[model samples]
Target chain A: MADGNEPRVFRIRVRGSDVVASCAETEKALIALEQAVAFPRPLPVNVGCRKGGCGACRVKVLSGDYTTIKMSRAHVTEQEEAEGYALACRIMPLSDMEIEPAFLSPRERMEMRQAQKFAD
Target chain B: MSQEGLLRPGIAQLRVLDMDEAVKHYVEYLGLEFVSKEDDGRVYLRAYDEFHRHSVVLREADQAGLDFFAFKADGQEAVDGFRKRIEDFGYTVDDVPAGEMPGTGARIGFTVASGHRIELYADMDLSEDAPETNSPMIWKTMPRGMRAQRMDHCLLYGPNIEEVEKFFTEVLDFHVPERVDMPDGAFAIWMTVSNKAHDIAFVKHDEPGKLHHLAFFLQDWNDIGHAADIMTHYDISRDLGPTRHGITRGQTIYFFDPSGNRNEVFSGGYTAYKDHPTRVWDHNSVGRGIFYYERQLNDAFLSVVT
Candidate 1:
C-alpha cells in the first residue's frame, strides 16, 4: 500500500438484489458496476462523460462511506444529495456499500425495503 | 472588443492558505512580478507585460478560493454608468473607495446570480516595470518560469448560468463567444469583453461562488510545454493539459497553486470578434468542446474548485 501500486478495495452490494461488486478507491463506482459479474448488464461505454459533466450513472447509496468528485448540480440537487443521490461515475467506495438505481421499478422498491429490514 | 466600457480582466484577489507558498507559485513558478505586501498582509503581483501596477492579489485565508474578480473600466464614467445598469438589472451595487488597494481607483461591486462577487474599477497606477516606450526592446527583463504573459481569464462554477450570462451580456456589455446549450438549458458559457476568446467563463453547479480556475496567458504553444516541464520539475500538483480547448482553441494545462486554487497556463486561442456569430455546442459534443483531444472532462474539472 505504501508503494502505491495497490489500492484498497471495497464490496458493492446492490440493494433489492443479491448482486455483489467490488471497487477500488482510485476508480469510479461505475467501473465497479461494469466489472461486477452479478450486475444486471454491462453499462454502455459511451453513455456518460466518465467525468462529472453528464449524470448518466446516477445511483442512491443506502449505506456506505465513499469518496466523491464533483457532479453537476443540475442533475443532483443539494436536497437530493443529502438524501444519498449520487452519480456512480463520480464516486469511489471506501467500505462495503449498498446502493440502488435512482429510478427503480415498483416491484424492486418493495423488494429493497424488505431486504433493507433484514440488514438493519 | 469595444472602445468605451470594461477594458479587460484587470485584478483578481485570491485567498490562499499560506502566503509564502502562494508567493513562490505566482512569482517564481508562474512568472508574475511581485509588487508589494500591504499592512493587511495581502501581496500584489503583475505579469511582465501588464502596464498596470498589478493584476493579481493574494490574501491569507483559512481556505483557498477567490475573494473577488474585478474588471478595469475605460474610466470613472463607464463604471458609474455600469453601476446604474447593474442596479437597474435587480442587483445592488456598492462602492469601494480609491486607494483601497494601493493605486487602484474606486470600484463598484456586486454579487451576481451565481453568488460570485464581481467588481469594476476605472484606474490603476502604471507599473515601473512596464515595457519600454522609446527605443524599446521587446521586454525590459527576460521572462522566467512558465513565462506567462498576462492574467487572461478565470472559470467559476455556480448555479443559474443562464441568469449570470444575461447579467454579463446585458449589464456588463460582454459578448457571448461560445456556449453549450444542453437539453435542460444553458449548460455553460464563454463570455468576452475584449478580442481574446474569453474573459470569464461559468459552469452550472449547485454551489455558488466556486472558483474553477484562473488562467495566465503564455506566448505560444511551446510555452505550454515549458509550463508542463516546470510543473513536473517542481512537483506541482497538476490537473490536466498541455492540451487544447476546443471552445477557445487554446493550448493549455491545468494545475493547482500551493493553496489548492486551480491555475492554468494558456496560449494560442482564437481572437474573438464582437460581430462573429456565437459558437454553439450540444450535449453530445461537450466532452470535445472542453478538451479537444480527450473529448471529455476529467473528474477534477467538475469536482475540484477553490
Candidate 2:
C-alpha cells in the first residue's frame, strides 16, 4: 500500500520520453506533465483545458489502470475510448502508465491500432 | 438602468469535484459570504454587496463546470414575458420550481443556442445579513478575501454563436456591445441587457456548454492588484491578468477555482449605452482586445474551460 505521506512515484511513459509523476501530485495526468515541463523540458503532447473539455491533451492509454472523469464525448467517441483513447486531463492513473499522444486523424489512428495488433 | 428585460447575473450554479475545497476557494479566497449547505450538499453563497439570500451555488459532481447561470428579471411579469419570447423564438422553456433553489422564485430555463443552460427569475428572499440599508453603511461585516461585489457576468464557449447572438438580442433584448470577427466568421460577442459593458459573453467553440469564466465585480484597479496579491499569497492557479482588457476596459485577474473552473474578479468597464456602436476586434487584434498589456492570448484562454 502507498503511504499517503510518501506517495509512490509512477513513471508516465509518453512515446519515447518518460516523466515521473506521483499520486501526491495533481489528479490530472496532464497537470503532472505540466509540472514536469516547468523544469524546462518540453512536454511531449499538446495540452489544453486541463479540465477535460478541449481534448488537446488526449492520449492513448496504451496500458494502465486509471480512472477517467467525464470528457467531451464529441472529441473521444465511445469506440475510440474502448480502443484506449483517453484525455490526459481527465485521466487519474492508478499505476505506471504507457501512453501516446492520440491527435492523429481517424485513418492514422486505425493504422496505429492495427499495427499494435500485429505486434501483439 | 434598464428598467426591464434581463437585468444582471443573478445566480450561477457551478459543479465542483470537491465541495469542501470549492467552498474554501469561493468563500475564503474569493470573499463571498457563506450562506448554508443544503441536505443535498449543495452550498449556497453570496457576495457582501448582494441583497438576495444567495447568488452562487456549488454542487459536488463528478465533473467540474457550470451547471447554469440565471439572470434576475425586474419582476415576475418580465420573467413570464421572456419565457414567452424565448419559447416563441423556437426553443423550449421550462419552469424550475421556486423552492428548487433556496429563496429563489420560479425560474424559466432554456438551453440557449450556445448550449448553455440560461435561466431567468424575478424574486428572492432578502438576505438576513444584507448590506446595511438604514444608514447605508459600508457593510454589515467587513468584506473578506477578494471582496467580490457581485456575480457580474460569465463568458461561455460553444458552437453556433451567430444563432446565439440572434437569440439573446431578439428575444431577451440584449445588444452586442463588443464582438470579435475571426477570419472564420463570428468568434466572440460581449452582449448586455444592462448598461454594463457585457452582462454575459459567448465565444465560439466546438464543445457545447463550456464555461469560460464567471466574473465577480471588484472595486477598482487597486482592488484588482489586491486580488492578485490574495491569489499569489494563497498560491491560487492564475490564468492571466492584473491587467486591463481593451475590449471591456475592465481591470481583471483570471484564476481557477479549486475545481479548475475559471473565475474572474474585475472592475471598471465603460457603461455600454444602448446607442453605442458595437466595438469590433479582428482576429489579428483580438489578443490586445482581450489582454490590453499582454497583447497576446494566453494558451489557457483559448483552450482551458470547465
Per-residue C-alpha lDDT of model 1 across residues B129-198, encoded as one tens digit per residue: 9988899888889998999889999999888899999999988989999999999999999999998899
List-wise, what DockQ does each model earn?
A: 0.05, 0.17
Flag regions of model 2 displaced more than 4 Å: A1-13, A16-42, A45-99, A102-120
CAPRI class of candidate 2? incorrect
Recovered fraction of real interface contacts per model: 0.00, 0.11
When only the first chain is scored, the TM-scores of the models are 0.70, 0.72
| Cα lDDT tens digits for candidate 2, B1-306 | 435767788999998877887899999999999999999899999999999999999988766789999999889998898888888899998889989988888998899887899999999999999888887988788999999989999999988999999998999999899999988899999999889999999999876788899999998999998999998798786778889999999999998886678899989999998899999999899999999998988766877677
TM-score per candidate: 0.74, 0.82
User: Best TM-score goes to which candidate?
Assistant: 2
Q: Give the TM-score of candidate 2.
A: 0.82
Residue clash pairs of candidate 1: A70-B303, B287-B295
User: lDDT per prediction?
Assistant: 0.83, 0.84
Q: lDDT at A59 for candidate 2?
A: 92
Quality of model 1 by C-alpha lDDT: 0.83
